[model samples]
Target: MEPPELRRAVAAGRVAASELGLQVDDVVVVHNSDRVALRLVPCDVLARVAPVGHLADSEFEVEVARRLNAVDAPVAELDPRVEPRVFLRDAFAISLWTYYEPAESEIAPTDCADAFLRLHAALRHIDLEAPHFTDRVAVALGEVNDRERSPDLPESDRELLSGTLSGLSATISTEHDRDQLLHGEPHPGNLLNTRRGLLFVDLATCCRGPIEFDLAHAPEEVGDHYKGADPVLIHRCRALNWAMFSAWRWRRADQMPDRDRWRATGLDNVRAALDRCHLD
Candidate 1:
Protein backbone atom coordinates (compact mmCIF):
# COMPACT_ATOMS: atom_id res chain seq x y z
CA MET A 1 0.00 0.00 0.00
CA GLU A 2 1.09 3.59 -0.69
CA PRO A 3 1.83 5.94 2.19
CA PRO A 4 -1.57 7.57 2.00
CA GLU A 5 -3.39 4.25 1.93
CA LEU A 6 -1.31 3.00 4.83
CA ARG A 7 -2.14 6.10 6.81
CA ARG A 8 -5.82 5.52 6.10
CA ALA A 9 -5.56 1.93 7.24
CA VAL A 10 -3.81 3.00 10.45
CA ALA A 11 -6.50 5.56 11.03
CA ALA A 12 -9.10 2.91 10.50
CA GLY A 13 -7.37 0.66 12.99
CA ARG A 14 -7.22 3.45 15.56
CA VAL A 15 -10.92 4.11 15.13
CA ALA A 16 -11.73 0.44 15.53
CA ALA A 17 -9.60 0.17 18.66
CA SER A 18 -11.13 3.28 20.17
CA GLU A 19 -14.59 1.88 19.55
CA LEU A 20 -13.61 -1.14 21.61
CA GLY A 21 -13.06 1.29 24.55
CA LEU A 22 -9.30 1.19 24.38
CA GLN A 23 -7.52 4.51 24.92
CA VAL A 24 -4.99 5.05 22.21
CA ASP A 25 -2.55 7.88 22.63
CA ASP A 26 -0.23 6.96 19.78
CA VAL A 27 0.31 4.37 17.05
CA VAL A 28 3.51 2.68 16.03
CA VAL A 29 3.90 0.58 12.89
CA VAL A 30 5.05 -2.90 13.72
CA HIS A 31 5.41 -3.96 10.11
CA ASN A 32 4.19 -3.12 6.63
CA SER A 33 3.81 -5.18 3.50
CA ASP A 34 0.58 -6.12 1.77
CA ARG A 35 -0.90 -5.30 5.18
CA VAL A 36 -0.02 -3.00 8.10
CA ALA A 37 0.44 -4.01 11.74
CA LEU A 38 0.23 -1.17 14.25
CA ARG A 39 0.88 -0.98 17.96
CA LEU A 40 -1.76 1.06 19.74
CA VAL A 41 -0.14 2.94 22.58
CA PRO A 42 -1.20 2.98 26.25
CA CYS A 43 -3.60 0.15 25.48
CA ASP A 44 -0.62 -1.93 24.29
CA VAL A 45 -2.76 -3.74 21.75
CA LEU A 46 -1.54 -4.85 18.35
CA ALA A 47 -3.86 -4.15 15.45
CA ARG A 48 -3.44 -5.93 12.14
CA VAL A 49 -4.82 -3.94 9.23
CA ALA A 50 -5.31 -5.28 5.75
CA PRO A 51 -7.52 -4.55 2.80
CA VAL A 52 -11.15 -5.24 3.55
CA GLY A 53 -11.14 -7.96 0.89
CA HIS A 54 -8.90 -9.94 3.25
CA LEU A 55 -11.76 -10.22 5.77
CA ALA A 56 -12.11 -13.92 5.26
CA ASP A 57 -8.40 -14.54 5.77
CA SER A 58 -8.34 -12.40 8.89
CA GLU A 59 -11.39 -14.23 10.22
CA PHE A 60 -9.64 -17.56 9.60
CA GLU A 61 -6.56 -16.37 11.48
CA VAL A 62 -8.64 -15.29 14.48
CA GLU A 63 -10.34 -18.67 14.58
CA VAL A 64 -7.00 -20.45 14.38
CA ALA A 65 -5.61 -18.35 17.24
CA ARG A 66 -8.65 -19.03 19.38
CA ARG A 67 -8.30 -22.78 18.86
CA LEU A 68 -4.58 -22.67 19.60
CA ASN A 69 -5.13 -20.61 22.75
CA ALA A 70 -7.80 -23.09 23.90
CA VAL A 71 -5.28 -25.92 23.72
CA ASP A 72 -2.60 -23.80 25.47
CA ALA A 73 -0.50 -23.76 22.34
CA PRO A 74 2.49 -21.42 22.07
CA VAL A 75 0.87 -18.86 19.79
CA ALA A 76 -0.14 -15.22 20.00
CA GLU A 77 -3.49 -14.55 21.56
CA LEU A 78 -6.32 -12.26 20.49
CA ASP A 79 -6.90 -9.17 22.60
CA PRO A 80 -9.17 -9.88 25.55
CA ARG A 81 -10.56 -6.34 25.49
CA VAL A 82 -12.37 -6.87 22.21
CA GLU A 83 -14.57 -9.55 20.70
CA PRO A 84 -12.40 -12.26 19.21
CA ARG A 85 -13.31 -11.43 15.62
CA VAL A 86 -12.31 -9.36 12.64
CA PHE A 87 -13.37 -5.72 12.81
CA LEU A 88 -13.94 -3.78 9.60
CA ARG A 89 -13.30 -0.05 9.46
CA ASP A 90 -13.30 2.13 6.38
CA ALA A 91 -11.63 -0.05 3.71
CA PHE A 92 -9.47 -2.05 6.13
CA ALA A 93 -9.97 -5.32 7.97
CA ILE A 94 -8.75 -4.82 11.55
CA SER A 95 -8.03 -7.48 14.14
CA LEU A 96 -6.78 -6.83 17.64
CA TRP A 97 -4.19 -9.03 19.42
CA THR A 98 -2.28 -9.05 22.70
CA TYR A 99 1.10 -7.46 22.16
CA TYR A 100 4.02 -9.09 23.90
CA GLU A 101 7.07 -7.04 24.84
CA PRO A 102 10.10 -8.26 22.92
CA ALA A 103 12.72 -10.18 24.84
CA GLU A 104 16.37 -9.07 24.87
CA SER A 105 17.65 -12.46 23.86
CA GLU A 106 16.95 -14.29 20.61
CA ILE A 107 15.36 -17.73 20.56
CA ALA A 108 17.86 -20.56 20.18
CA PRO A 109 17.42 -23.13 17.43
CA THR A 110 16.86 -25.94 19.93
CA ASP A 111 14.27 -23.91 21.81
CA CYS A 112 12.57 -23.09 18.53
CA ALA A 113 12.40 -26.76 17.65
CA ASP A 114 10.93 -27.62 21.05
CA ALA A 115 8.27 -24.91 20.73
CA PHE A 116 7.45 -26.08 17.23
CA LEU A 117 7.11 -29.67 18.46
CA ARG A 118 4.70 -28.60 21.17
CA LEU A 119 2.77 -26.56 18.59
CA HIS A 120 2.55 -29.52 16.27
CA ALA A 121 1.30 -31.70 19.10
CA ALA A 122 -1.49 -29.25 19.85
CA LEU A 123 -2.24 -28.75 16.16
CA ARG A 124 -2.78 -32.48 15.81
CA HIS A 125 -5.91 -32.18 17.88
CA ILE A 126 -7.29 -29.24 15.87
CA ASP A 127 -10.06 -30.22 13.46
CA LEU A 128 -10.29 -27.03 11.46
CA GLU A 129 -10.64 -27.30 7.66
CA ALA A 130 -7.71 -25.66 5.90
CA PRO A 131 -6.15 -25.57 2.46
CA HIS A 132 -3.59 -28.19 1.53
CA PHE A 133 0.04 -27.19 1.04
CA THR A 134 -0.46 -27.83 -2.67
CA ASP A 135 -3.04 -25.06 -2.67
CA ARG A 136 -0.27 -22.67 -1.57
CA VAL A 137 2.02 -24.01 -4.27
CA ALA A 138 -0.71 -23.52 -6.86
CA VAL A 139 -1.01 -19.87 -5.84
CA ALA A 140 2.68 -19.31 -6.41
CA LEU A 141 2.57 -21.41 -9.60
CA GLY A 142 -0.23 -19.20 -10.88
CA GLU A 143 1.85 -16.08 -10.22
CA VAL A 144 4.89 -17.38 -12.03
CA ASN A 145 2.80 -18.63 -14.96
CA ASP A 146 1.07 -15.30 -15.36
CA ARG A 147 3.41 -13.07 -17.31
CA GLU A 148 1.47 -9.96 -16.42
CA ARG A 149 1.67 -10.69 -12.73
CA SER A 150 5.39 -11.25 -12.91
CA PRO A 151 6.35 -8.87 -15.65
CA ASP A 152 9.76 -8.17 -14.13
CA LEU A 153 10.63 -11.87 -13.89
CA PRO A 154 12.81 -13.10 -16.73
CA GLU A 155 11.41 -15.93 -18.81
CA SER A 156 14.23 -18.31 -17.79
CA ASP A 157 13.78 -17.52 -14.11
CA ARG A 158 10.04 -18.04 -14.42
CA GLU A 159 10.64 -21.44 -15.97
CA LEU A 160 12.98 -22.40 -13.13
CA LEU A 161 10.42 -21.46 -10.50
CA SER A 162 7.61 -23.15 -12.40
CA GLY A 163 9.50 -26.42 -12.72
CA THR A 164 10.66 -26.43 -9.11
CA LEU A 165 7.18 -25.68 -7.77
CA SER A 166 5.56 -28.36 -9.94
CA GLY A 167 8.03 -31.15 -9.23
CA LEU A 168 8.36 -30.55 -5.48
CA SER A 169 4.62 -30.07 -5.11
CA ALA A 170 3.94 -33.39 -6.81
CA THR A 171 6.58 -35.18 -4.69
CA ILE A 172 5.27 -33.68 -1.45
CA SER A 173 1.62 -34.31 -2.31
CA THR A 174 2.25 -38.07 -2.26
CA GLU A 175 2.69 -37.94 1.52
CA HIS A 176 -1.02 -37.87 2.24
CA ASP A 177 -0.71 -40.33 5.10
CA ARG A 178 1.48 -37.80 6.92
CA ASP A 179 -0.75 -34.88 6.15
CA GLN A 180 -1.73 -32.70 9.10
CA LEU A 181 -2.37 -29.04 9.88
CA LEU A 182 0.85 -27.02 9.60
CA HIS A 183 1.89 -23.49 10.58
CA GLY A 184 2.52 -22.87 6.82
CA GLU A 185 5.51 -20.48 7.31
CA PRO A 186 7.21 -21.07 10.63
CA HIS A 187 10.35 -19.12 9.81
CA PRO A 188 12.28 -17.02 12.32
CA GLY A 189 10.40 -13.90 11.29
CA ASN A 190 7.08 -15.44 12.31
CA LEU A 191 8.50 -16.60 15.65
CA LEU A 192 8.45 -13.80 18.19
CA ASN A 193 10.86 -13.75 21.12
CA THR A 194 8.58 -12.35 23.78
CA ARG A 195 8.53 -12.05 27.55
CA ARG A 196 6.29 -15.09 27.71
CA GLY A 197 8.60 -17.10 25.47
CA LEU A 198 8.92 -17.66 21.72
CA LEU A 199 5.33 -17.56 20.52
CA PHE A 200 4.47 -18.04 16.87
CA VAL A 201 2.41 -15.39 15.11
CA ASP A 202 0.85 -15.03 11.65
CA LEU A 203 -1.49 -17.99 11.72
CA ALA A 204 -3.13 -16.85 8.48
CA THR A 205 -0.93 -19.20 6.46
CA CYS A 206 -2.11 -22.32 8.34
CA CYS A 207 -2.49 -25.27 5.99
CA ARG A 208 -2.45 -29.06 5.90
CA GLY A 209 0.87 -30.66 4.96
CA PRO A 210 3.64 -32.95 6.14
CA ILE A 211 5.57 -31.72 9.18
CA GLU A 212 8.69 -31.52 7.05
CA PHE A 213 7.02 -28.84 4.96
CA ASP A 214 6.79 -26.60 8.02
CA LEU A 215 10.28 -27.54 9.19
CA ALA A 216 11.61 -26.40 5.82
CA HIS A 217 10.84 -22.81 6.84
CA ALA A 218 13.05 -22.93 9.92
CA PRO A 219 16.81 -22.69 10.27
CA GLU A 220 18.61 -25.76 8.94
CA GLU A 221 19.94 -26.57 12.42
CA VAL A 222 16.39 -26.53 13.79
CA GLY A 223 15.58 -29.70 11.89
CA ASP A 224 18.44 -31.41 13.67
CA HIS A 225 16.73 -30.81 17.00
CA TYR A 226 13.30 -31.78 15.73
CA LYS A 227 13.51 -35.57 16.00
CA GLY A 228 11.70 -37.85 13.49
CA ALA A 229 11.91 -35.17 10.75
CA ASP A 230 12.74 -36.68 7.35
CA PRO A 231 15.84 -34.91 6.06
CA VAL A 232 15.13 -35.62 2.39
CA LEU A 233 11.57 -34.38 2.68
CA ILE A 234 12.71 -31.25 4.50
CA HIS A 235 15.20 -30.50 1.73
CA ARG A 236 12.54 -30.88 -0.93
CA CYS A 237 10.15 -28.66 0.96
CA ARG A 238 12.92 -26.06 1.39
CA ALA A 239 13.29 -25.84 -2.37
CA LEU A 240 9.55 -25.51 -2.76
CA ASN A 241 9.48 -22.80 -0.09
CA TRP A 242 12.16 -20.81 -1.89
CA ALA A 243 10.39 -21.17 -5.20
CA MET A 244 7.12 -19.97 -3.67
CA PHE A 245 8.80 -16.98 -2.02
CA SER A 246 10.61 -16.12 -5.24
CA ALA A 247 7.32 -16.21 -7.09
CA TRP A 248 5.74 -13.92 -4.53
CA ARG A 249 8.63 -11.46 -4.68
CA TRP A 250 8.38 -11.34 -8.47
CA ARG A 251 4.75 -10.32 -8.41
CA ARG A 252 4.32 -6.91 -10.00
CA ALA A 253 2.13 -5.77 -7.11
CA ASP A 254 4.29 -7.02 -4.23
CA GLN A 255 5.34 -4.24 -1.86
CA MET A 256 7.38 -6.16 0.66
CA PRO A 257 10.37 -4.33 2.14
CA ASP A 258 13.66 -5.00 0.32
CA ARG A 259 11.73 -7.04 -2.24
CA ASP A 260 14.40 -6.83 -4.91
CA ARG A 261 17.07 -8.13 -2.55
CA TRP A 262 14.78 -10.96 -1.40
CA ARG A 263 13.87 -11.85 -5.00
CA ALA A 264 17.51 -12.30 -5.92
CA THR A 265 18.29 -14.17 -2.70
CA GLY A 266 15.30 -16.46 -3.14
CA LEU A 267 16.38 -17.46 -6.65
CA ASP A 268 19.86 -18.20 -5.42
CA ASN A 269 18.53 -20.29 -2.52
CA VAL A 270 16.26 -22.26 -4.82
CA ARG A 271 19.06 -23.06 -7.23
CA ALA A 272 21.41 -24.01 -4.39
CA ALA A 273 18.77 -26.27 -2.81
CA LEU A 274 18.10 -27.96 -6.16
CA ASP A 275 21.81 -28.51 -6.73
CA ARG A 276 22.22 -30.03 -3.26
CA CYS A 277 19.26 -32.34 -3.92
CA HIS A 278 20.78 -33.43 -7.24
CA LEU A 279 24.04 -34.28 -5.46
CA ASP A 280 22.22 -36.21 -2.74
Candidate 2:
Protein backbone atom coordinates (compact mmCIF):
# COMPACT_ATOMS: atom_id res chain seq x y z
CA MET A 1 0.00 0.00 0.00
CA GLU A 2 1.20 3.49 -0.77
CA PRO A 3 1.92 5.74 2.22
CA PRO A 4 -0.96 8.04 1.26
CA GLU A 5 -3.85 5.60 1.71
CA LEU A 6 -2.47 4.33 5.02
CA ARG A 7 -1.60 7.80 6.24
CA ARG A 8 -5.06 9.07 5.31
CA ALA A 9 -6.76 6.32 7.27
CA VAL A 10 -4.59 7.03 10.28
CA ALA A 11 -5.32 10.78 10.12
CA ALA A 12 -9.10 10.42 9.63
CA GLY A 13 -9.89 10.12 13.33
CA ARG A 14 -9.36 11.62 16.78
CA VAL A 15 -6.92 9.28 18.54
CA ALA A 16 -6.20 9.74 22.21
CA ALA A 17 -3.12 11.89 21.85
CA SER A 18 -2.78 12.30 25.60
CA GLU A 19 0.03 9.74 25.69
CA LEU A 20 1.97 11.68 23.10
CA GLY A 21 0.75 15.07 24.38
CA LEU A 22 0.18 16.17 20.82
CA GLN A 23 -0.97 19.74 20.39
CA VAL A 24 -3.91 20.23 18.00
CA ASP A 25 -1.39 21.18 15.32
CA ASP A 26 1.26 18.83 16.48
CA VAL A 27 2.21 16.15 14.00
CA VAL A 28 -0.32 13.36 14.30
CA VAL A 29 1.55 11.18 11.88
CA VAL A 30 4.66 11.08 13.95
CA HIS A 31 5.60 7.73 12.45
CA ASN A 32 4.86 5.67 9.39
CA SER A 33 5.48 2.10 8.31
CA ASP A 34 3.96 -0.80 6.41
CA ARG A 35 3.38 -2.30 9.85
CA VAL A 36 0.30 -1.60 11.98
CA ALA A 37 0.99 1.91 13.27
CA LEU A 38 -1.71 3.29 10.96
CA ARG A 39 -4.56 2.00 13.06
CA LEU A 40 -3.25 3.80 16.11
CA VAL A 41 -5.28 6.81 14.97
CA PRO A 42 -8.12 8.00 17.18
CA CYS A 43 -10.57 6.19 14.89
CA ASP A 44 -9.47 2.83 16.14
CA VAL A 45 -8.68 3.01 19.86
CA LEU A 46 -9.81 -0.55 20.52
CA ALA A 47 -7.44 -2.07 17.95
CA ARG A 48 -3.99 -1.08 16.80
CA VAL A 49 -2.92 -1.71 13.19
CA ALA A 50 0.32 -2.17 11.26
CA PRO A 51 1.49 -3.77 8.03
CA VAL A 52 0.47 -7.34 7.46
CA GLY A 53 3.31 -9.80 7.89
CA HIS A 54 4.72 -12.40 10.28
CA LEU A 55 4.39 -12.16 14.09
CA ALA A 56 1.68 -9.53 14.12
CA ASP A 57 0.13 -10.74 17.35
CA SER A 58 -2.20 -7.76 17.88
CA GLU A 59 -1.95 -8.09 21.65
CA PHE A 60 1.61 -9.35 22.16
CA GLU A 61 3.49 -6.10 21.63
CA VAL A 62 1.35 -4.12 24.08
CA GLU A 63 1.67 -6.85 26.65
CA VAL A 64 5.40 -6.97 26.08
CA ALA A 65 5.76 -3.19 26.25
CA ARG A 66 3.83 -3.12 29.50
CA ARG A 67 5.95 -5.86 31.03
CA LEU A 68 9.11 -4.24 29.75
CA ASN A 69 8.01 -1.01 31.37
CA ALA A 70 7.70 -2.78 34.67
CA VAL A 71 10.85 -4.89 34.42
CA ASP A 72 14.14 -3.49 35.66
CA ALA A 73 16.21 -4.63 32.68
CA PRO A 74 19.09 -2.61 31.31
CA VAL A 75 17.41 -2.35 27.87
CA ALA A 76 14.39 -0.86 29.65
CA GLU A 77 16.32 2.29 30.52
CA LEU A 78 16.83 3.59 27.01
CA ASP A 79 13.58 2.65 25.30
CA PRO A 80 10.93 5.10 24.23
CA ARG A 81 7.42 5.12 25.70
CA VAL A 82 6.59 1.70 24.27
CA GLU A 83 2.80 1.53 24.04
CA PRO A 84 2.39 -1.35 21.62
CA ARG A 85 -1.09 -1.92 20.22
CA VAL A 86 -2.57 -4.80 18.27
CA PHE A 87 -4.85 -4.91 15.22
CA LEU A 88 -6.30 -7.56 12.93
CA ARG A 89 -6.69 -7.35 9.16
CA ASP A 90 -7.63 -10.11 6.76
CA ALA A 91 -7.00 -12.52 9.61
CA PHE A 92 -3.42 -11.34 10.00
CA ALA A 93 -1.67 -10.16 13.15
CA ILE A 94 -0.66 -6.50 13.05
CA SER A 95 1.03 -4.54 15.83
CA LEU A 96 3.16 -1.42 16.33
CA TRP A 97 5.99 -0.56 18.76
CA THR A 98 7.27 2.99 19.08
CA TYR A 99 10.92 3.65 18.33
CA TYR A 100 12.75 5.27 21.21
CA GLU A 101 14.64 8.53 20.86
CA PRO A 102 17.79 8.09 18.82
CA ALA A 103 21.15 8.38 20.50
CA GLU A 104 24.72 7.17 20.34
CA SER A 105 25.63 3.61 21.17
CA GLU A 106 27.25 3.74 24.63
CA ILE A 107 26.27 0.29 25.85
CA ALA A 108 28.48 -1.53 28.34
CA PRO A 109 28.99 -5.04 29.75
CA THR A 110 27.37 -4.06 33.04
CA ASP A 111 24.16 -3.35 31.14
CA CYS A 112 24.37 -6.63 29.25
CA ALA A 113 24.92 -8.73 32.37
CA ASP A 114 22.27 -6.86 34.35
CA ALA A 115 19.70 -7.07 31.55
CA PHE A 116 20.49 -10.73 31.01
CA LEU A 117 19.81 -11.62 34.66
CA ARG A 118 16.57 -9.63 34.78
CA LEU A 119 15.23 -11.01 31.48
CA HIS A 120 16.14 -14.56 32.50
CA ALA A 121 14.07 -14.12 35.65
CA ALA A 122 11.12 -12.79 33.65
CA LEU A 123 11.21 -15.70 31.19
CA ARG A 124 11.30 -18.11 34.13
CA HIS A 125 7.93 -16.76 35.24
CA ILE A 126 6.10 -16.31 31.93
CA ASP A 127 4.31 -19.13 30.13
CA LEU A 128 5.80 -20.00 26.71
CA GLU A 129 4.79 -23.27 25.09
CA ALA A 130 4.51 -24.01 21.39
CA PRO A 131 3.05 -26.62 19.05
CA HIS A 132 4.80 -25.90 15.75
CA PHE A 133 7.94 -24.54 14.15
CA THR A 134 8.27 -20.97 15.50
CA ASP A 135 7.62 -17.92 13.32
CA ARG A 136 11.37 -17.40 13.01
CA VAL A 137 11.64 -20.76 11.33
CA ALA A 138 9.07 -19.58 8.88
CA VAL A 139 10.99 -16.37 8.25
CA ALA A 140 14.29 -18.21 7.96
CA LEU A 141 12.85 -20.75 5.58
CA GLY A 142 11.20 -18.00 3.60
CA GLU A 143 14.63 -16.51 3.05
CA VAL A 144 15.94 -19.84 1.89
CA ASN A 145 13.25 -19.96 -0.76
CA ASP A 146 14.11 -16.48 -2.01
CA ARG A 147 17.80 -17.29 -2.10
CA GLU A 148 17.35 -20.20 -4.48
CA ARG A 149 17.34 -17.85 -7.45
CA SER A 150 20.88 -16.57 -6.94
CA PRO A 151 23.23 -17.86 -9.62
CA ASP A 152 26.26 -18.15 -7.35
CA LEU A 153 25.35 -19.72 -3.98
CA PRO A 154 27.82 -22.54 -3.42
CA GLU A 155 26.75 -26.13 -2.73
CA SER A 156 28.20 -25.78 0.74
CA ASP A 157 25.97 -22.77 1.32
CA ARG A 158 22.98 -24.89 0.54
CA GLU A 159 24.36 -27.65 2.77
CA LEU A 160 24.76 -25.32 5.72
CA LEU A 161 21.17 -24.22 5.37
CA SER A 162 20.21 -27.87 5.13
CA GLY A 163 21.97 -28.39 8.44
CA THR A 164 20.24 -25.39 9.99
CA LEU A 165 16.85 -26.63 8.90
CA SER A 166 17.54 -30.14 10.05
CA GLY A 167 18.79 -29.00 13.42
CA LEU A 168 15.77 -26.76 13.84
CA SER A 169 13.44 -29.55 12.74
CA ALA A 170 14.94 -32.08 15.15
CA THR A 171 14.10 -29.72 18.00
CA ILE A 172 10.45 -29.64 17.04
CA SER A 173 9.67 -32.78 19.03
CA THR A 174 12.33 -32.18 21.69
CA GLU A 175 10.69 -30.43 24.62
CA HIS A 176 12.29 -28.62 27.50
CA ASP A 177 11.32 -28.52 31.20
CA ARG A 178 11.27 -24.81 32.07
CA ASP A 179 9.23 -22.69 29.66
CA GLN A 180 8.47 -18.96 29.37
CA LEU A 181 8.07 -16.15 26.85
CA LEU A 182 11.30 -15.04 25.20
CA HIS A 183 12.72 -12.45 22.84
CA GLY A 184 14.01 -15.05 20.39
CA GLU A 185 16.08 -12.25 18.84
CA PRO A 186 18.02 -10.55 21.60
CA HIS A 187 20.93 -8.40 20.41
CA PRO A 188 22.68 -5.20 21.46
CA GLY A 189 20.70 -3.02 19.04
CA ASN A 190 17.47 -4.19 20.66
CA LEU A 191 18.77 -2.36 23.71
CA LEU A 192 19.59 1.31 24.19
CA ASN A 193 21.59 3.39 26.66
CA THR A 194 19.91 6.44 28.12
CA ARG A 195 18.93 8.23 31.33
CA ARG A 196 17.31 5.00 32.49
CA GLY A 197 20.61 3.18 31.87
CA LEU A 198 19.69 0.36 29.43
CA LEU A 199 16.29 -0.13 27.79
CA PHE A 200 14.96 -2.98 25.66
CA VAL A 201 12.69 -1.87 22.82
CA ASP A 202 11.80 -4.66 20.45
CA LEU A 203 9.25 -7.29 21.57
CA ALA A 204 7.70 -8.33 18.28
CA THR A 205 9.85 -11.45 18.42
CA CYS A 206 8.59 -12.54 21.84
CA CYS A 207 7.25 -16.09 21.93
CA ARG A 208 6.59 -19.05 24.23
CA GLY A 209 9.61 -21.34 24.20
CA PRO A 210 12.57 -22.64 26.17
CA ILE A 211 14.09 -20.10 28.53
CA GLU A 212 17.42 -21.33 27.21
CA PHE A 213 16.59 -19.62 23.93
CA ASP A 214 17.23 -16.31 25.60
CA LEU A 215 20.18 -17.67 27.55
CA ALA A 216 21.65 -19.05 24.37
CA HIS A 217 20.89 -15.90 22.43
CA ALA A 218 22.10 -13.66 25.23
CA PRO A 219 25.47 -11.98 24.68
CA GLU A 220 28.34 -14.01 26.09
CA GLU A 221 32.06 -14.48 25.52
CA VAL A 222 33.95 -17.27 23.77
CA GLY A 223 37.69 -17.72 23.70
CA ASP A 224 37.40 -17.47 19.90
CA HIS A 225 35.37 -15.62 17.11
CA TYR A 226 35.03 -12.62 19.43
CA LYS A 227 34.19 -9.04 18.56
CA GLY A 228 31.84 -6.23 19.61
CA ALA A 229 29.63 -6.61 22.69
CA ASP A 230 27.87 -9.79 21.56
CA PRO A 231 29.42 -13.02 22.85
CA VAL A 232 30.10 -16.06 20.70
CA LEU A 233 26.59 -17.48 20.74
CA ILE A 234 25.00 -14.15 20.11
CA HIS A 235 27.56 -13.53 17.38
CA ARG A 236 26.66 -16.78 15.66
CA CYS A 237 22.96 -16.08 15.93
CA ARG A 238 23.64 -12.61 14.59
CA ALA A 239 25.35 -14.03 11.51
CA LEU A 240 22.51 -16.46 10.83
CA ASN A 241 19.84 -13.85 11.37
CA TRP A 242 21.80 -11.43 9.20
CA ALA A 243 22.11 -13.96 6.42
CA MET A 244 18.39 -14.51 6.72
CA PHE A 245 17.81 -10.80 7.10
CA SER A 246 20.07 -9.94 4.22
CA ALA A 247 18.46 -12.54 2.07
CA TRP A 248 15.08 -11.08 2.86
CA ARG A 249 16.33 -7.59 2.14
CA TRP A 250 17.99 -8.63 -1.07
CA ARG A 251 14.92 -10.47 -2.24
CA ARG A 252 13.05 -7.24 -1.67
CA ALA A 253 15.48 -5.49 -4.01
CA ASP A 254 18.02 -6.96 -6.44
CA GLN A 255 20.77 -9.51 -5.89
CA MET A 256 24.40 -9.24 -4.84
CA PRO A 257 27.26 -11.62 -5.70
CA ASP A 258 28.86 -11.22 -2.33
CA ARG A 259 25.49 -11.66 -0.61
CA ASP A 260 25.15 -15.40 -1.21
CA ARG A 261 28.80 -15.94 -0.33
CA TRP A 262 28.66 -13.80 2.81
CA ARG A 263 25.43 -15.52 3.84
CA ALA A 264 27.23 -18.85 3.60
CA THR A 265 30.14 -17.51 5.60
CA GLY A 266 27.75 -16.26 8.26
CA LEU A 267 26.07 -19.65 8.43
CA ASP A 268 29.37 -21.45 8.80
CA ASN A 269 30.47 -19.03 11.54
CA VAL A 270 27.18 -19.45 13.38
CA ARG A 271 27.34 -23.23 13.20
CA ALA A 272 30.90 -23.17 14.46
CA ALA A 273 29.89 -21.09 17.46
CA LEU A 274 26.88 -23.29 18.14
CA ASP A 275 29.14 -26.34 17.96
CA ARG A 276 31.24 -24.77 20.68
CA CYS A 277 28.03 -24.51 22.77
CA HIS A 278 27.19 -28.14 21.92
CA LEU A 279 23.76 -27.01 20.75
CA ASP A 280 24.28 -27.71 17.03
Highest lDDT, which number?
A: 1
Off by over 4 Å in 2: 1-21, 24-49, 52-55, 67-84, 87-105, 128-135, 142-156, 168-179, 210-212, 215-219, 222-280
TM-scores for the candidates: 0.98, 0.58
Q: Candidate 2 on 1-280: residue-level lDDT in tens?
A: 3556455435432233333432223324443334433223332222234444444343555566555556543343211332344434443444434334455665556656666656656655544443232456666656555556533445566555646654543453253334466676676656666554565655657765554445444455321222222243343444344445434433443333355565555666656755664664
Residue 108 shift from truth in candidate 1, angstroms: 1.5
